[model samples]
Target: MKDSLEVLPGIELSVIHFHSERFTMHHELFSDVLEVNYCHRGRIGWDMRDGSSVFLGAGDLEIHTMDCCADSTITLPLGGYEGITVLFDMEVLEDHVPELLKDAGLNGRALLKKLCPGQTPLSLPASPEISGIFSCLFEVPQKLLPSYYRIKMLELLLYLEQLKPSHVNRLTSYQSELTVLIREIHDFITADLSKRFTIEELSKKYLINTTTLKKIFKAVYEKPIAAYMKEYRIRQAMLLLSQTDDSMADIAGQVGYVNQGKFTQAFKEQTQMLPTEYRKRCRLRKMEKE
Candidate 1:
């Protein structure tokens, strides 16, 4: 891990990197600062204490308040994850640039409260300009990181404030009682890509109200449970197709599809390519590289 944390007068900037295949961590954010996370590579999942969660993939950004309790657990996928986090001190902003903060449509209070009013964490897929900044952030000299970080931080604030209010994503909060358990259910479903299970069975096993389960699952992950699973399974299948020489039947089975034809259809719908054709193209590219 080549993680670095730099603290300037009032702002703390961190560039984090992890190399594990998969890992989970319980994080308690700082109470006095607003945190902004930019996912530079891989995927990062945030399981909130209130039963809602959010996943930030590469080039995605999330802004949220800090909690004293370990209110969130982050999960990183295989090949690990890399991200940049900026912690802005609200007091510092208020004392130094109150006008600038107000101009940015923020009041220097809790970032979530100021920006989202009464909402959950704000998660947005980065626009090209923001994405380009993240992509080039680490390319600068180590000595210049602080200046670069400060510039980028200001740029991000300006960009975010300039966007239409509707374009700024604001995730919804859920009941506290459901947070951890729903996250557990999510972990269970994603733990095995090859297993198929219904919401009824999951509801029964977890003893959560079926309707509430459906609602909170969407609140946390931004998609219905079944759709999330389907997309996840398909993503795994695509990875297998491009990275391995496994037979189509085996790949399909690995991704929880027992019927090859059904898997083909799903693959086509997601990637516009049959599994075999995708594999062949991958192989051709590999051979060409050689």
Candidate 2:
């Protein structure tokens, strides 16, 4: 779902929530626009033209011109993403600088140039100041949303203008070859949740160095192998819980947990409820709908 609001002339704010593996961006429509994206949850990977990939995880920010993402394929390695994007139409913004911004001596065009400087996007980890600004955007009273967005947008631009070059994160890109291998590895590992694979074992099997495997895997999946798999297993367990009548022990074993006690503990850790409780809740909801 995408919800857009024009907070100011030529300045639009959009809340984006997508669930899918990949999608191609039609950036041609917004050629002269500057886009600022903040990932609130999940991960997004951009397949750049230079045979490399850039990823953004929770609390990360990416700024770029629309041209930079033209025809680019965005991949959600985790199959889902939620974020906010603020688009600046450089021409309109430059032509009519808002009175509030003029009073503060803020120039939207200058800020875009400063942040972008090149065709490649600028991605940075969220500093505390940035986090504090964006967190408030997620929850605002409906009546005050427009005014709230205007204030926060202005605050964000001012804060960004003060950022030094050193404060920017060095853009990290994973080679296309490694990204492909990592995807293959992901499929292999997740193809059967009942089996567990160690880093060393996968390293030997895939002919990639263990360190490289772990680094690239984490970059693509946003978590180390074990942690990613643990979350994946639990999520799959959730689906089975909601849809099937399998015994708890059977569900645990299907997701690679041989011990019922360990499975229950992991389930509680991820969902804050035991497996049986979760299943009961699902059933109750289904019955209510019926």
User: Which candidate achieves the best TM-score against the true structure?
Assistant: 2
Tens-place lDDT per residue, model 1, 1-290, is 64555444456778888765334455655555667888888766666544666667678888766652255556553347888987777777667653434566654564445554444567777578768667778689989877787777777666655656565554354554575577689889888878888999999999998999999776555578888788888889988988887888888899999888989999898888888888899889999999
Measured against the true structure, the TM-scores of the candidates, in listed sequence, are: 0.62, 0.87
lDDT of each: 0.71, 0.85
Q: Which residues of candidate 1, in runs, are more than 4 Å off?
A: 1-8, 15-31, 38-72, 76-83, 89-170, 175-177, 190-195, 242-245, 288-290
CA lDDT for candidate 2: 0.85
Candidate 2 is scored at a TM of 0.87
Q: On residues 211-270, what C-alpha lDDT tens digit does candidate 2 reach at each position?
A: 999999998898999999999999999999999999999999999998889999999999
lDDT of 1 at 205: 97
Lowest lDDT block of 10, candidate 2: 23-32
Best candidate according to lDDT: 2
